[model samples]
Target: MGGAARVRRGAMRFGVERRDRPASERRAERGGTGRSPARRRCVGRPIAKARGMTHSPLRVAVPLGGTDRGRSGLGTWVQAVLPRLARRLRARGGELLAIGTPRDLDAYAAVLGEARPETLPAALDRAGASAGWHLAALGRLARRRGADAVLLPAANRRLSLGGPPTLAVVHDLAELHVRGKYHALRTPYVEHVVPRALRRAAAVVAVSGATRDDLVRHAGLAATAVRVVPNGVDVERFRPGRAPAALRAELRQALGFRGPFVYYPARLELPGKNHLRLLEAFARAARAGALPHHLVLTGSDWGAWARIDARARELGVRERLAWLGRVDAAWVPALVQEADAIAMPGLFEGFGLPALEGLACGTPVACSDTGALPEVVGELGVRFDPRSPEDMARALATALTHPVVRRRAAEEGPAWAARRSWCRTAARLDALLEEIAVAPGKAVAA
Candidate 1:
């Protein structure tokens, strides 16, 4: 579809009702300085401003073209952080120009009502060509808007060192640590291409301290250049005890599991996400009569899905397994709240969002002790060894059956999530950007 048509479609999809207005009024609303759209246009190019449009001190260009249809953990981070981050930047006499394909912009517009988004051609929507678009067009787009810096939210995937002054957010280095996380062809990009770009960035934001350490140790990035910025959850939206009984009933009926269940929200990928082992643990617990709750898995399939299904069947626990493929975002909070417990059996997690979300909903979480899960969950989660099914079954039992542990999680989870709000995250990010924008030369040198 054409870019303009996609924008219109996106606006319509989000219930952005259109109203006809005078051209001058529309121009005024868009911050144009009393000039007609045609008058400001340069014939061959799109016009961002009139002859005298006011310029914000700090204009940051955010590229979302490489973000995969707003799925995955990276997508969740973008949706949660960008709206708050945009508000923070605007409050300080700054502007955020989000660049993406029309569909991506549409997704952002749903959350960010006042976002100033520029559209890229739909051809860049393909995975392989996304980085090529960033390499060739991102800098030009930033330069057109006089952007002070470019913030790459998923920098490990899409990066352009030639851009104004790039600030990269590295979510995880899981592919480097976990074998078969990426295909053999894509492994080299994660190993070489991503690290090389991180080295040249003006500053790199690691989603967790564990990720920061990994960058320093494995990627050879300077510790000083890498800053640890943890991802935050929406406490208001994900708070405990608010989900209606109707919603819970609906969720239960949809999953075809009427009894209590353990919710594991993650992609069905092997070795890295470790769903196969989770199945084994579930079967072990079920057979021993140690666990009463059914296993409910929510996420899109990423290869190894067949293996997960086959393993469940072989273990004779397929009937007890509820695979709600790729759950809707609106249903996530209710799903978490209604579940008996949350399970994350990933081999390694840079920052375990499910653990945080589960805590926020007052749902007890049983997650792997490895990676940043320990750091995020702290004393709240029921930690276990991911490699051992015995340990996982034990943790799952505690989270589901232990009265004292469940009560403590229900009472304390909300407060724990409150401390890690998106507001605080945005403030920290604003400060970091301000520092880099204030002294670009020094930032680049470092």
Candidate 2:
């Protein structure tokens, strides 16, 4: 029995000896060093040296699969920044990976084309299923793709518990500030899940200083953890201009009766958007014969459409209110250009994008004094108390009747907006990503 055991052990030793040949011997048999340059350098090498060679072209995975169809504020950010961001990344031997459902890919096709886009399975298109995929499969996908980090542009709504070190963009804590901004069921997720996720991120980007402050104050995040990168407008696209005659004629016909109109392009939402108060203000101004311009409302109905319509009718300004519904995004700059004034009366805003767009279009802007509107609109905005119909009415009346206000906006608004260009936003974001990538114990090891 001992001799048989010795024989078995001898055979095992011989086999192991053959498999574990010397590196030189193996290399000779393989006809020279068999590993690729990257593999050769990486094998048994210091992680820092290996990382310096193999981690070239740093990759960031961006998972996007919500039903927003790239129409929300984040969507606008993506549209404005992605193309520029992609170019900058490529310049530095990095790439952007956009993974999303077919619908999402289609929604931002042009902007997304700048990145390496991969489509998620159609089954993961629904909201619940998509969220689950993001929670479960995102990390796996990042690993398979060798992504160095994950970039969640709409991190407030989408995030993963596990992934490459993450950079989360927090647009607002609107749910915490404005009651009923979202469904009651969703409020808890925002209150609990979102804050936890934001805390877990390697970095957090707030689109406005106000949003950054909210993150620090409400989310219990350290001020150092949050970086303020304000949203930017595509000044080239949203600059002062009239629609071509054909498009102008189309808009005129769509409105039925339109001379000069006051434009307020925001999602139709309640106390959050302050649409009701703005309607009341418009009604008051119209009734008092202080305002002659029709109120042009654009955007999809969120939850307050019925109330807004009812109030407009009740105030007897229904005819004066032209509900253009959600017009094409391409039509927005022209709509602003031809308007007598732009009104953004949201009670609370993280970054009042419409106000910025209006300013970019060289249109006189009448925006709320609260939140980021004042910050975004600067001295150009005719500020008003969003909660007070009287103040709103006064601002609206001034914007419409004051030719000096209109002329000054036409001259200065474009230049002011030019400073907040998408190019600058993209540069800041690129720098942030680079910093995150090379930070010790983060993405650099990957």
The estimated TM-scores of all candidates read: 0.84, 0.83
* lDDT (Cα) of model 2: 0.74
* lDDT of each residue in 113-182, candidate 1, tens digit only: 5458888888888877888778667888898788898889888788885758888888888877788887
lDDT of each: 0.74, 0.74
List per-candidate RMSD values in Å: 15.0, 22.3
Model 1, TM vs. native:
0.84
Per-residue C-alpha lDDT of model 2 across residues 1-446, encoded as one tens digit per residue: 23233223323321111223235322322323332222231112222342353334568888876527766777888887777777766765779998888888888888876599888889887777887788778878987898887888887788777767788887887878788787787678777777877777778888877787788887788776787777877766788777789988888898888677899988888778889999998887676554567899998888788999899899988888888888887688888888888999888888989888888788888888777777677667777778898777777766666656667778978766655656656666666665666672342110
Residue 320 CA error for candidate 1 (Å)? 0.7
